[model samples]
Target: MLTPRARPARAAGGAPRGPPPAAAALAPQPAGADSPAAAADGSPARADSPATAADGSTLVRTGAGWIRGESTEEGRQFLGIPYARQPVGDLRWKEPRPPKPWDGVRQAGAFGNRCVQSASWDPGYEKPSHTEDCLSLNVYVPDGHTAQRPVMVWLHGGGLTAGAGEDIVPDTFARRTGTVVVTVNYRLGAMGFLATKGADGLDGEASDGVSGNYGLLDQQAALRWVRANIGRFGGDADRVTIAGESAGGRSVCTLIASPTARGLYRAGIVESGAYGDCAGRERERATGDGAAFVKKAGCPDPRTALACLRAKPAKDILAAQAGFDWGPVVGGAFLPVQPKEAYENAGAARVPVLNGANSDEGSLFAFSRYDGQGKPLTAGQYPQALTDAYGPELGGRVLTAYPLTEHASPTHAYGATVGDRSFACPALRLNTALADRGPVYAYEFADRTSPPFASLRELDTDFDFGATHVNEVQYLFKHFGLATPLNAEQRALSRQMLQYWGSFIRDGVPRADGGPTAPDQRTRPGQVLSLRTASAGGTAISTTVGDEHRCDLWDAVPAG
Candidate 1:
């Protein structure tokens, strides 16, 4: 069962802060009507005529109250609705509570504050924008439409630490595909993952005298909110498809196996994430480590832990946060068992699944370059490292599959092999497993050799990061407005990709209209579509690139 609260922040002892300046300024504006005479004059007429609503204004009814959103050209309706009550003060480390109903139309044009996070990787990270009382969601829908449309809920990825729903621009998908898109913000870091011993001494349960896995609970609250209120936005809540990449993909996998999330979404797309058995119930006993760390901080007991944490400044929390490898815990009422166990026992929702991975996932996490102290490992070092990590025999097999000699440098080889095993290979494993339960579509993005980012230009490497992680996003969203225009062939392929994705959301299958048919047409083993640049101009497709690339080899490879 799940518990909901309104304003857990107040219970924690701290008062909620007023809406930030950004949020306060989202009041709706009126649009202006243009006159034929004025248009003939060609003089820039008054921009805000009587016809338009002033900037940043919209209204939508929600489960809790009437929410007003800011307007943008991307869509007709947008609501920055608060799905769960603020988690401030006393509510600091507890599970999410339901948001209290407001008496009147609540202004929701501005984005809510993001959860407290470090400014290490993200330049937009600001202090005022980070807080404990951040449990809001943003909704985008077609303008003036009352009919139900397919809904796509997006989860952002920042390694479960940084990134906001506001960062993603839904204009392309909303305008091009005509789907209602919802992006959400959830708790992160210690605030979300910390597990305390319950009264019953169980992990992630109330018995530990504390709530745990608050982040996961926060997502559930968002989904519940969508189910209860999406209809108001002309969205068919029952047809909702949850999609995400990276850590968001990990969360999708978790939700796939989470009993609480069973009926929340009908289909799921996990890009670059895998369903695997990592740490499980028995492994969570060490969550008491938080208690020990608190004790080391000179706190008396668990009761004082929340207060002590709150009283400590944000910087202190960040500084002390080092050395803690926090993530979702199993054995909780929410999870019940490990994800792998749930998947194997057929405990997961029986829904169509689309799972795939980029060719080079580890390049994004090139820690050696970031640390600056260690030299990039050489090709000779990879085999030993693999052997050390996975044993000599297994390491030999891994080396044979990912032969470092095939690459120009050791770093390139290591990154490719690790990325394949850690992300790509496991994705294949997941698809294989899900295929037995329901219709499954699997893919591998292999676009290689794109223009290098300014940061990587100095590397002077010829290594084929082959479709490095996130490279597919450009084609998927078309947000950047690339300088080099895609030729006719490329445009055709782009349309096909978009149509496939859009159709998949509309129905359960991702099929294109009027195309060459093959044995693996749509549903067959080794059925994969390869999108590549053709010699003539735009792009070409090979029904199955695996025959040439030996993609089936991926199925036998063990996950790192």
Candidate 2:
């Protein structure tokens, strides 16, 4: 999802929280290759092993070194484990390297610093982060499940500029789903996606002289780490499922299109991510933007631009990158072609995919642009706003399709247009494309009364967010370590969602005992599983998403 690139209106930077008492170190267990307690990699044992520390913490040995994590009530959590070396100084913008091996146990309690980014509406990332050493991931495994359980690698959504691996507490999800969950944090914004033609070092690290997609590469590195080491955590690396929402969902699609990421995972779960052209920006356009970014950073000299960028403070570069769209770039070894092209040409990974979008995916975006700031959209200004966004021809067609009188307000009407043009239509196209290659289960999160995030709740507005973008995250996992305000019915729906997701991760199908069956796109074309509470019409196979959301009208327009 292409969110507003403008930094948050509120002040950046918040008070950093202190680590929990479980941050204490643990001793490694005495084990060898012949010991039954030893892991598959000849490392220390699992959570139930005798390696538990005096304080009830668990120690696991990785290829790098020993690390101690907390034993939670629901499962075992290993937080802040670096999957790659710190991207600082000369290492910035380069491909991620393996973290150096440690001598003793490293405390894997508190989460690592978030990738360098400005604050956003997400409560988990409301504070600006300046740290560059943020290429770490967190793993959550259930307490009793010690076998090779299926793994789900989650990528947090922050428009590819903000957010961290700790945005959601997945311990409960891990325990309930009976799967090992891994959340990751990679580089963000320009620091991750900048593709300057001449920023390579003397060693020719960026030898092509045209470099970008470092963030995408970072994600691949994390997946590679999972393949190499997840088995030690009792995770089945061969059954890994890459799942994400928004930008993270888009990252899943990009990874699906990437050749380097083929063997890292077997399946993917995409939520509200089917927007924009996954092929990414062309090399010429990205380098041109990179050149402008370099000049904006006060390093106009192409000869010294790389040195200047390397020397300038991270905050300076973050400030200079304002207004420029940050995402993956094409024509690189990481992603050689567009994702759409890859899917169409059968060049994409042949894996089962569970993909969908929220019903009113653009309401929050509309609120941010209009209602959130106190200037609600007026009926008189609606026509001009549409023209400004989609031009006169498309704007007039949109107005005819979504009349203001049909919606609660002009803002709602505008939101409907945006959601259809951006999310719903794009997602339908992706479902069709992916169904041609492999099984693709499609869904629509139609829970109109879904709870808002902490940031949205804090806003001084009375606008109704109807299953907007990111609204479904709270249902699947605890957002910001807080419980959702779900009612009895919503809670039941949440449980069903978790069950469906769990089944998808464990196997390739999404089925629950009593819940509605999620049909694959190949079996039921143009229909998706509509997920909502019993009172909100209940969950069922909905055949009206296409006509109701006006995808026919949007099919003519370009996806954002």
Candidate 3:
């Protein structure tokens, strides 16, 4: 069913609300070419390929039922494994329940459903095929690896409202890096972030009567599943790297700060989205009020709110999502304060981190706001907008640093400057602040520009959304199914990225076999790897991108 953006237009207590009838129209269907089937033991067939071993025939065990996956030139793929149980019926809005043990082998050939989201915002030209029962993950293991390999767990980004594990295919990285790649799906939108008033009468407690953070809890559950079952797939559970982009990146930061997430992973890779504290107490309280509003609409008894939510049709739950204000909350047992406070106070999980951002982070959001309809805003207008959004002093500093006059167009300068301060710079600050505690590898995706989506390219002409927010994902995962296909140079860069990422997962630092070479050396003091393509070849340019940009200034900015 079609739904609007997840954020609500009205606040709680303003009016009565109910689930939309459109939600009931949604029906469960098999995802893609793979479907769940019973194995010889009457359990779900596993997706692991029997021919995936060095001898071209091996069986791997997993938490769920097992079967053989396809072995191809790319790599061996295992799809549709349930990392957690289906969050349906009585389990709705509660802590993730463990997947029920099956009596026999079950088939896991297909990917589980992606968390429910608005179809409008999905950028890869694909749509969500499944709903709330979407807590599954996919794994890619290289064919030649005999011993347990390093693992990289990837989290996708879609503003906490959209995105799925199916969006990324880690085959290329798996083949090139010889590491196990696991991409996961968790609760999103209202199902994940909506916090309701607890039966204990505590106003700000989590919706599940614990600390609210079901989405984060879902991610932790997947990590636990990985720690328990990854070894069977030739992966080293002890050496794990948690990585993400945009909202996924934000999640990486959140995971580092969450006490429940401690010891689950060894390292982190945060791309684009890394704000110190994206959600605050007021925001969390607002989310709770939104949930209460939903409960009042459906049932009079507060004790059975969860039961009522489960009995309500999926469409109704999704439709009611429009009325709910959702995001992370602070002052709860799980997360006592915002992420920034936790990090600055040294209350976060201490681990090596790899962080960076695109040059045109703001263009994506700007393009979305302008509707690709009118001319881009002017340079003067850019500062005016910042002042409107933030306050005066901060807006003035932002405009001075990223003067619009320097660029060919106001939109270009505005996007570059604001995007850096709001998204990119904060990420750099996170790395710098945490560097002394552990190793930090920083980079900037300075690819001149990305091939534009046909529809969006026509709207903003002057500004070349250089390596916009999610552009690096296809390169990182080597899977462009949801994105445009990569060119030869792009493919080469993907290989380099895979090497850097895999090496990091293997060790704390991201160094390749030959060690830091001249042109594309690893990140060091005063060195920021620039991912650019030259006539000779695509290589890393050691230009002080991070230092020159004054990323250190973030250290002084008080944690929000």
Candidate 4:
């Protein structure tokens, strides 16, 4: 249910990519509701409506070329702009290449197709239809943002199997925070993560060439594109921050560890997808899956495997890609080691980190037959689930620490137990590692009564959603309309959260004007922000989240 983040005691940029550039500026607007853009072809959009007019198309120039954008109330939005070459034909399974320079202005009024993946979260956010050629990004520069405003790059989450950049509208963040935002859609599922030996003119024994982690590389390409051209859109290239949740969060973690991602951004925010120690086996297993897929696609021969796989229907290849482990693989050139190892060795990009998880993270995986109204499951149910998940020894310890009577139901008890050991504590563990290395800030979003995105409510069953895995997102951004409308107190919390994040992007530290100060682990060990609502009493500055989550117990449980 929960994603993850890295942490360290309170404290505080990496390599520069591409060639150097000249200074840039924003042309002042006429200072009115209705105004004209300064430059028609290559000038920055009017701070009010720089490139676009009321109810008309806006245009902005990227490093590659000029593109027209769609207009919104807060600012002009450039949607479905390709950052890299379409990953189709021979490009499939290969590292992303730069978009072939365009001859003329491209129309970016609508979103490109979403990368091929499984079904999206029905009713949560409207994702585009699936296609193999779906490597695009969207940019939203708020009306009043200056040339020096912080740029927030967003990656959507669906456990690396689904989601697209268009899923979340950038209007809320741009309007609320006055920040330039870019959301990207990378390759997903088998199309993105499949690994194979002797594909792409390389072999298992060959030295580092292209990685199987193409999704990660696609994200890198987006960042690089931003580095080279975001200034044209009024973004400060030096002040970029990468942010995401769930599988998107996992992307953030891997990016921090990726050598290619060095100097790409100044900060990172991982909501819940940053747990679990890395293993060297993901590459091998994914490689095996690729081999199986090639055979199943009628391309067992190494010579034509890639070609045949590329020629197959997207759905057919994805059907073959489903059964394997589809996340990032360690022991590849991009990783060289596990993400945890990279962070601990100070091998990651040493940017200021803001990482945390929700209070009730694991309930989403609730057994369908069982309801989750916080009801206690049968005594035997919780224990057996534990024993089945972990052998009897660890299972008994889990049961003793969390007996059925302590919860509303056996389902809830089991969920709570798995949540603590699996999501919450592991995240805290990551924060501890981060704190040891640099300035880190941690938080626990505990506003349980808040409504999820309208689409997420489609998932409601007999069980209560609580402040589960994705609930915190509503307090931060619209999350592509995945969140419900906020009440007054929840609205205040949302404002506070935005202020904190804005401050972090602007100043690399999460602090509020009159609110609680989130502390660094070195100066204030074990302190984390309790992002609750005034309705839930009041937001906390120093919540004992580690203690409540029973991190000590999880620390003792052996790693699988």
Candidate 5:
């Protein structure tokens, strides 16, 4: 029942232009050969280059070539390593291919260019990017690691249009969790998700003239890369976990339903990402969107649309897709059915899932629509706001259930309604759907006092963000390439969260030594873990999540 609409670019960065220079052709080495002679086989060792430099930089050899990364007190970080060939020119909308082997050592000290996107609040990515050589991933390996550790592959969330792997530096998290972390960058916007039906020219990427979902395919290719090469970095490829926030979180669920993604990951962690009832766009809708996009991009003829669109500049495609929604397309081999159907029918990957949302999941969205635009909602406008968001009939019932008298302001009431209907209820429903198929753990981040990311702080609005969307990301990792320093109490909560997530990634189950026991949804039914600071009663088990979030009322509301 999820409908596609123009997705907002909520994150930031500058737009970079042009394609990356082709890699110098080099003979491929045997995969996973780590001998000293192998290092000598590629390029002569630099007089100043040492395995461990005084600046803590180190050189690590991957299957394709040799690369150097920097070291920190916590771990060694390899940034901007290409996972796939640049999706440019003839391969614009095609499926990702294995990266071409490169000669000599590829300096991985800096992150590669982010996928072309318009700017927003994301710190390092505030400028728009025009580069297509963005299919890269960053690796974080804890220092002095002896054995193969569990691996966590992170996907950044920007409504599938913005953000990159550099959004969060996970060296500290990798060290604390004792796991290998890999953050990835995939195609975004029109270059990533444009699908046109009857476009035979695009059939090379998929069967039956299918198109779109290139971004999702890029992610799969990254996972394949991890499976093939993670062992060389001291990671257990078989124990990989896929986790993300918002759009990335939705991708986690979609991948669970993808037949092609089976065995790529052992488990998934969803953070405030169960929007649209955890469903994918239908094929007809996706094709309609794509066809419209094709016409707008000056490629109206389906017979020649693929070639025309691919010939257009990447910037032109980005401009033409300004007001379109981009996401996975159902009815293809990549995604045969809606994710909701997959979970209900037990067709999804049978793996453990840890899913949850924040306490005020809708506050940020409401603020953006109201106060963030300098037009705070008034008491008189509350009814109309609900009617606009939901239909008049459903809005009336929602208004009656959440009156202004019960909230601090009109925005608060609207936020509560949006949060329950969009995030909280959907997550609860997904937990129940997956519980019967496999172990399921649920949680609600209740630390309302959590600090906003640097971008939000710069917004300089009086809107109380509470534990809104993307707020919990800071407790687990550095957000938007900047660290949100935590207070003593918040630090404790961060440690506890790391414990829960680390345990889930390392083992199939989520376990924390002294924290509250996270009960499986199958056994606990309506119960969930409430993540908070010690002064706020600390992290503990809660049996009132459904009632508090008003899932009972939302369950009966119309999905569309």
Candidate 6:
């Protein structure tokens, strides 16, 4: 594999410092909420099963309180449930705390407020009711579930700066495959990743107090909540599996390697995201941005930075961090070391990993340079873009491998090269790293006609995204209302994928009943399960990744 990046920073004591930041311990729901008077508002629930409480809604008695949900034929959805206390005011930038108790039955009918994200260049950065009190999560339990089913908690992806979990609920994913689904919201941008004790003088310490990665810490708190509360929702907390796409996928990969997340999950699924390749050490980025925020907030004094920064309006703070890539950073007690090294040694989490990338994962990324009218790059522009992206030598090799004659245009070839280098190869590297430890099942999602999700510039730009990033997500869950539906063939592929995923979550193996007969090639070469179409050799499982995607030469490319 490509020599791993600079080793990540680690601390001797792995736990958070400064007296655990006040647990804000959540209280159980009041007994009065279950009174007959409250039950009269809605039809009283007949105690047929344990998933629902009185009032006929799919109610769950969580540690914080009783959450009343909207029950439908498809599933019982409890939305906008606060997994942690609101991270506003003094709680801002501190580790997530358990939500405080609520009064009467809390109505979980709609999605919670999305975490604040700065103005972005991608269409996925669409508008939402932005707020700092966005530590809520949603849970959907499928119908006819009497036992503890495997849970799949989803984390949405937007480069760690934007996007919300409500975009794709468990409407179809739950009903079809008998699994509980949970979607979560975490802090983003400056609110999420301000990694320094210098300014806040809180999580940051003179010694090992550099407290950044609050977003990731939020994910951990959410998972811990699931571990404690999902059982009341007919979910097996012990059988929980964490899944995410893109930045969310990176979160899953991070959790796999994080000492903080050990034993919280049984299996992990990463789609279109890997570790170390995307976000990096937060020391420099966070320090630079924190300094800028201090200046912008008019809080130059490090001693008074917290008070002054909080005094500033939310819009000004967001504007200050608009262009910065503020996401998870290495160091701190959260992600202490480089994820690759953490998972590389014998002691890393030995759970099963079902990870893969789409066939054209990088097509939509070319939108920044592609000209109008949906054509490829110009003859001169193609070489310039490649050279600028990969210096000279590697860029030339990438261009030669994907010539204009092979693809529709120069842009198409360039997109392929980007996909191979950024996503596909790194995924292969992860598979290699984890195979020796346990059962490592990798795949290639090659359904070119798959429907797309998220309101993005590429969708409206007349560009053929061609099974690009986030395309596979539509099949796993119903896309947003405005997005199109899947075709017949795509539906079949979705069923196949669901079966594989469900089996893996339930049994820690991708196949329905088998223990994954794929050879253990970590010390040598390995094969991957390719999810191609019926016509393209019918979803063959083999070690042909080198020839199929030209991974051999791409692996040798510098810094690929």
| TM-score on alpha carbons, each prediction | 0.79, 0.91, 0.80, 0.86, 0.90, 0.86
Best by lDDT: 2
Q: Write the per-residue lDDT of candidate 1 for residues 1-560, one digit (tens) a residue.
A: 00000010110001122434433232222221122112112343242331221122254546565555555555654545788988776677777888876644466655677776666422234232346667888777756544578888888766666656654556566666778788888987667766666665444334234545677788888999889878767788799998877667778878888898888999887777672423232434536656655565555566766567767664555555546655567775677777777777897778877777665666654433321235676666778876875688877876776776676566666665556556765765576666656777766655554433222333445444556665555555522222224556555655656666677788877665533221122256555544444433323234444433334554454444
Candidate that beats the other on lDDT, 3 or 6, i.e. the better one: 6
All-Cα superposition RMSD per candidate: 8.9, 4.8, 8.3, 8.5, 5.0, 8.2
Q: By TM-score, is 1 or 4 better?
A: 4
Candidate 1 residue-wise lDDT at 274: 72
Give the alpha-carbon lDDT of every model. Answer: 0.60, 0.81, 0.63, 0.70, 0.79, 0.68
TM-score of 1: 0.79
Off by over 4 Å in 5: 1-57, 199-210
Ranking by lDDT: 2, 5, 4, 6, 3, 1
Model 6 Cα lDDT, one tens digit per residue, 324-433: 65766666556766677776776457888888888888776664456434655876688778888888987787778777778766777778887888888788888887
Following a full C-alpha superposition, what root-mean-square deviation does model 5 have from the true structure? 5.0
Off by over 4 Å in 2: 1-57, 124-126, 198-204, 207-210
Q: Which window of 10 residues has the lowest lDDT sum in candidate 5?
A: 1-10
| lDDT (Cα, tens digit) per residue for candidate 5, span 267-290 | 999987788866777778888898
For candidate 3, lDDT tens digit of each residue in 1-560? 01112111111111212311222121132322233343333455345532223333333445553444545566667666778878887677777877865433234445556687765534342443336878878877787757578899988777677767756667767777778888899888777876656644322333435334788889999999989988877888898999988788888888887787889999998887575434444544754565565665575465666566668876666666665555566655567767776777888888988877776666665655442557567655777876774579866776776676666566666556556666766766676556645666777776655654333443435546667767777676533233346677765666667677777788767664323432212235445666664443455645566654545553455432
Model 4 lDDT, full chain set = 0.70
Flag regions of model 4 displaced more than 4 Å: 1-57, 124-130, 199-210, 278-281, 367-369, 372-377, 459-462, 558-560
Best by TM-score: 2
Tally clashing residue pairs in candidate 6: 3
